[model samples]
Target: MKSFKHTIRALACAFTIAAVSTTAHAAELRLGSGFGDNHSSTRAMRDVFAAKVEELTAGRHTVSVFANSELGQAPEMVNQAQSGINFGVFVSSAFFNSQVPEIGVTNMPFIFSDRETAFKVFDGPFGEKMKPLFEAKGLVVLGFMELGFRNITNSVRPITQPEDLQGLKIRLQNNPVHIATFNLLGASPTSIDASEMFAALSQGVVDAQENPYAVINSFRLYDAKQKYVTDTGHFFDVIVFAVSKTALDAMTEEDREAVIEAGRLATLEQRSYAAADEATNLETVLSKGVELTRLTPEQREAFRTATAPVLDEVKSRLGAELVDEFLSAVDAAK
Candidate 1:
């Protein structure tokens, strides 16, 4: 009788251990993005990061992606992540600027002359310098993706020169630096969320907006009756892959390392995908019947000349030292 009782107790202990182990092995993370499912950023997370994480963790951990702002707008998703709401986000530098104003330095007009130069700067020390800003705000900076160079689109008219942009009501991102920059260029700029952009354009709430060629194509802004597209290449924005620090801290050490590695790989792959897709996206926009304008060197320089003073205006807000470091990095990359 004594032996039977001991055997029963051991069996119960083993069952409990098995249950606990099974529970520990099943962990899931939610990654959210404002981009559509087909967007490269979303695809990278779904195809690269998700696969890599699953492989590294031996199926013990997985990622569920919410694309097309299914989770929420950038700001809301960012808040959810910070509050430990089982979320991660690929936030745009413009929106993330709300949390870390220093990031606005990257949004300065004409800072990067081309994609290669921009990539070199971001993948170098300057990019690493911005990580702690996110960490301090209770977010983990996983990696950076490309938002590509911003171009101008309008229902009003082609913007080939600084004078052409005059009197247009432009929809600017909810970034003060962007607002100020457009305002300086003589356009009336209004802050609007990306989710509401199509309606804003369709209803004539704003006559103009700016984004990368890929974004314009992905969002189908041509459907909003935007008649003209200008390759302004004004700013090279970054999409930051970030997760809640609280959520990261709760992960096991091995799982945490796996997550980090997945992010690094995904970022690298996504950047390449975005760069290669730019020309194709430009073609798509043209096929949609929008007039596409490629500004000459002189025409682009006119824009540069007009917005140059914005650097001085925004320096105090973004920290002079930080801006100097960014410019120095750009110079070095060149």
Candidate 2:
């Protein structure tokens, strides 16, 4: 009888411990971002997501961030999330374009005239129509994170004309559209992953690369042997906060809303912060002793004209009708 009583008490203690642990871990959302935590956008996301999750869940749910490839490379992390290996990743259109070829429409070179046009397309129909497509692939896109516009940075001579890029070896994200676009512009495109780009640029594996000023500043590209910076603004980038559909489905309604709401707020705040920093970031690059090769408005137009073939190439990947729909939506947006 004593033995039976002792066994009963032990089982009760085990059950009690398990119950407490389960409750404690019941609603955690793990997020990953490509940029280091020090970057403004990454830091904004971490702070806003965590604070909003706690507020909306009344402290029952929470969020934590893994920044600077702590989870994995941006593209690989999204794949893992889609496969249900992890929670989610913050990734750019470059990451999504390869997965959903239909998404390549967003990668149309020189599509947006400015950040305002870019925002219109994203916040309007073009962005809304994409959520269902993402859901079909076991990923949940919470909100669009603006990656600003891409411009060329090179160790070679200044690129004031399209002919200047001839035979130049440029590092491009491992995306079909990006590679095709650069190839169309007469550069030898090397498909390098973002995590490896710094080393690739430093070692002369690539002569130039393109990214927004924020990235150039955040990654300290000035230290990577780059010489000239151009304001081609050739393409705008859009990153989505993607979560695993499996994980999202498992969350309680309240917890799920909390997570999504947190992401939406983060997007708004980050976009504002990014807009205000572009000039400052460009100035910082110059202050670091990197030479600026300002693209004349006419030269920018020529680069755009030269890359026009990329739109048709992008259409072929994303489907012609989808491309038309995306462009139409862009026109219709307020």
lDDT winner: 1
Clashes per candidate (backbone, < 3 Å): 0, 0
The local distance difference test score of model 2 is 0.83
- The window of 10 residues in a row where model 1 has the poorest summed lDDT is 20-29
lDDT of 2 by residue, 250-284 (tens): 88897888888888999888888888888898989
Among residues 3 or more apart in sequence or in different chains, the pairs in candidate 1 whose N, CA or C atoms overlap within 3 Å are none
TM-score of 2: 0.94
Q: TM-score of each candidate?
A: 0.92, 0.94
Looking at model 2, which ten-residue stretch has the lowest summed lDDT? 25-34
> Which tens-of-lDDT digit does each residue in 1-334 have in candidate 1?
9999999999999999999886664477888788987788998999999999999988888889998888888789888887878558996888787688888888889988887898798889988888888889988998889888999999988888998888899998898788888987899999887888999999999999999988899999999979999988888888989999988887799989999999999999999889889889999999999998999999989999999998997788877888889899999999
Report per-prediction Cα RMSD to one decimal.
Answer: 3.2, 1.7
Steric clash pairs (candidate 2): none
